[model samples]
Target: MTPAPAGLTCRLCGRADLRSVLDLGAAPPCQRFMTADQLDEPEPGLPLHLRLCADCLLLQIPPLLSPADNFTDYAYYSSFSSSWVAHARRFVERAARELLPADAFVVEVAANDGYLLQHVAARGIRCLGIEPSENCSDAARRRGVPVHTAFLDKATAERVRAEHGPADLVIANNVWAHVPDVVGFTRALATLVAEHGRISIEVHHALSLVRDAQFDTIYHEHFQYWTVLAAERALAVAGLRLVDVELLPTHGGSIRLWAVPAASDVPVSGAVARVRQLERTAGLDTPAGYQGLAPAVGQIRDGLLRLLLDARAAGQRVVGYGAAGKGQTLLNYAGVRPDLLAWIADKNPYKHGRYAPGTRIPVVDVDRIEQERPDLILVLPWNLREEITGQLSGVGRWGGRLVFAQPRLTVIDPGAAAIEGAA
Candidate 1:
């Protein structure tokens, strides 16, 4: 992996006044799963640290790796998670009813596998997807969702606009934080939308990250973690006005922002002010709010290590669930290995035979859970705890328990209540 450039400046304001908030030392790229042959080869590690800009108040990490390094042949597929697809369906339905015109055209940036645009196309609306991964784009095409396999930039956005005209609704879900060029990408979003068109962006709220001690979400793939205050500043640079915002439960906690060209005379919704107040109340309006995160992160790491070691000492088998990017961060930071985690189960077949990047834990099919019936199943993607718990409810029949390692470690009997908390 490439080292972060010397004298790193804030990506948003181009200032060198970036304060270090939390550091996870160096870790391999979260999404870079290793093949069995490559396990013995040398692995590259990059610094995974969160910094706050004093000038712009943007919470970001240094751009250690480019987008191509992680996304070229992506391992993640949006359709794997049933709940996320249902979330996309609901967003498309709401956009068609309230935001779109009768003959509206839609464009989705970083649209993975056409999870959302499939819904738009099913409703007879004209839609297109701009994705960076060819494999993911192919999956979208199979679903009859037209996609252009290219990263969104100023030139690409201009070409798309010239060919298809301006889009009525441009949806960029959970991608605002993926790009290193924050201001430029925001400009591309503005360039893709019509003068009176609306742009929807979903990003993990920084408030949740700081408040809930969710340091696992801080990885190289996500360049920025945003709150309403920071988002408004970035949007203004692209001549887009933040008119509305909604708090979502996806990705631990997220906020969906609605924006329009500054030239448009649309009135800002009260939800924007309400969310700003919520951020202010949470102490996110200033850099002081970012304090105490590193210590909280340390406590979580210690707790997770204690749980895994105790389980091992007791002769209980503890396996993992969800071969997710965040899981990679948590495992590498806490120094978890195959001996402690055994094998991780994932529904995505692409990762079935591969090993996790740094720890080299095996990734297997979900059916292994039923075959082995491990005593403890650590649910890595805590955000999807409800859905994962329901799928593994049968583990209770075998006296298997579910474990959540973040925001505090909680052990729950599969079909019963939470039996333990914070080891």
Candidate 2:
């Protein structure tokens, strides 16, 4: 595949001293789930070079594909994971108590399946979802949430504001990193938000990515990674102020940042200062903090490959669970093919007969696992291991075990049932 124009400078800070941190080989668009007929066709793969900006402490990958190529007909649905949906429900409740006003207008960018906006609408408040994926947006509209099927940028933000007025609360959860133009994305949110409005951003913390060795989360879809410091810098550059920040445990480790127009009189919350201080103490302010990640990531990849190869050597059938973006990255980077992993099982019908993007492994329904009773089930999305393990606990009856390949390759013994938080 041809390489797209790379961003020579950092997305947050216009610096050219971006240091190479990790190279996980070539990867395709993680969300590009292929159909059964397309499996034999050639797939595109772009260089995966994760770079770190010393100037702003931001971890970013250069732009490789246009947003339309990645998001227009996306296959990812946030409501698939019960835990994630529960997390969104809890977030909506908390926002109602803390940030959201009684009769406020709420807008969520990159809202998939109206997971969070459904809660806002249920509370009798005015809400809208700005999602680029037509399939996801259609699902949201069916759930009674008004949605705009357009990518959020400066122009789209202006049009949204003119049509529906400034939003009292604007949310861009998990989309900030997906945006190619980081500066323009921030400025667009600023345009949609009112002067007194709160702009909430949930991003996977770069510090956590290094600290926890979350290399699987690094894919072509996520263009940038942010620490509190880097995020604050980007927001400030777009005429926004970082008012508050909360470190959440979701998505390995994420930071929910609260911002407002720079000219607002809102006093910055103590949480912001505390998180900044915590990040600084964790060595996020220097280049040494970013060191050692490449090695740890390499170790995990090698370990996972070893387990799969050993299982195949022993004549054990190994099937995978969860056709997630992180799973695609991990499988592709580890050079796992259909022979080693067989097929992956997912509950989403849209992906049931489809093939994985880069690996081209067939995605079958979850019942197929019970039908085949593979000896070892590799749980690809390790973040939802507990939920998935519990759902497939019956596999243990047939002497089937579960495996995970994050931090390290762990094999859960057969008949070992998991509680909600066990994993």
Query: What does the lDDT read for residue 43 in candidate 1?
Result: 88
Which numbered prediction scores highest in TM-score against the true structure? Answer: 1
lDDT of 1 by residue, 235-334 (tens): 9999999999999999999999999999999999999999999999988887787888999999999988998999899999999999999999999999
What TM-score goes with each of the models?
A: 0.98, 0.95
Where does model 1 exceed 4 Å of error?
Answer: 1-6
In model 2, where do residues sit more than 4 Å from their true spots?
1-7, 417-423
The number of clashing residue pairs in each candidate reads 0, 0
In model 2, the worst 10-residue window by lDDT is 414-423
Clashing pairs in 1: none
For candidate 1, give the lDDT of residue 109: 99
